[model samples]
Target: MNLLNTLKICVIAFLFTSLLNTTTQAQITPVLTHDDALKMILASKKHAELSDVLVNIAIVDAGANLKAFIRMDDSYLGSIDVAIKKAKTARYFNIDTGKLGELTQPGGIIYNIEHSNGGLITFPGGVPIKNKNGKIIGAIGVSGGTIEQDKSIALAGAKSLLN
Candidate 1:
């Protein structure tokens, strides 16, 4: 009878501990809200305006899902898909697209990788947005501008999360 009671107590303790751990893990996983994505898009637009360049901006969650997007007046229609691809590339790889571009060059480790994944923009315009814990929560991409301008604008958007 004592053994039975002890076994029951152990089982109950194990269940309680497992439940607590699951809750704690859920709380620690960061989720990027829609408002956060909007803030990033707006900030990127502001930066693009300052540069006198029209752009298409896109934000994607950590799962490479599009959350928000905008195309500035006079921006190229072709850039719409590019912007989304960049954001997805950054989020999927958890790395900036600029660096990914370099790594995908001829003789590089990931050469020809861009041709896969249905199409990816391995250029300087996508950046991952990481939480305070250094975990990537999402990414922002900018297009319809020079690579330099696109990169600058995307950086602005990614930095919005710091605030």
Candidate 2:
């Protein structure tokens, strides 16, 4: 009887685990593809080149996870992490990092928010990518240049999907 009971419990656990996996898979939303990431990177790099600046770029999907990255030759090594964080910050809040920086300023709303979210980049260079339905799909970030230049590059990347 004990052996039979144990076998029944094992079957029940297997069934439950299978059900959980199916539910998780069904709930997952569409994610940006590698080709999409490459398009963003190429557009951003072109913009940076036009500005005569090398930069590190990062792309993050809707879940705020890093999906792709590129570092131009001679780009600042320190900016690699900054670029990733900027992408994540934009995706996490569904807002551009530049705008978010404005809110994080001293005495402004959401001040010190940079201290949260495992460290955020509360500066320019991050832009959110949105679908035609106005749903945020991802974000892009560029670093290793002046804030304005970085923002210009990031904006180019963020708009790549439109074309």
Candidate 2 C-alpha lDDT tens digits along 108-138: 9999998998899989999888764566889
What would the TM-score be for candidate 1 when compared with the true structure?
A: 0.81
Clash totals for all models, in order?
0, 0
**Where does candidate 1 stray beyond 4 Å?**
1-29
Candidate 2 — which residues are off by over 4 angstroms? 1-30
Q: What lDDT would candidate 2 get against the real structure? A: 0.89
- CA RMSD per model (angstroms): 4.8, 9.1
lDDT of 1 by residue, 95-162 (tens): 98999999899999999799877899999899998865578999998999999999999999988777
TM of each candidate vs. truth? 0.81, 0.79
- Angstrom error at residue 93, model 1: 0.8
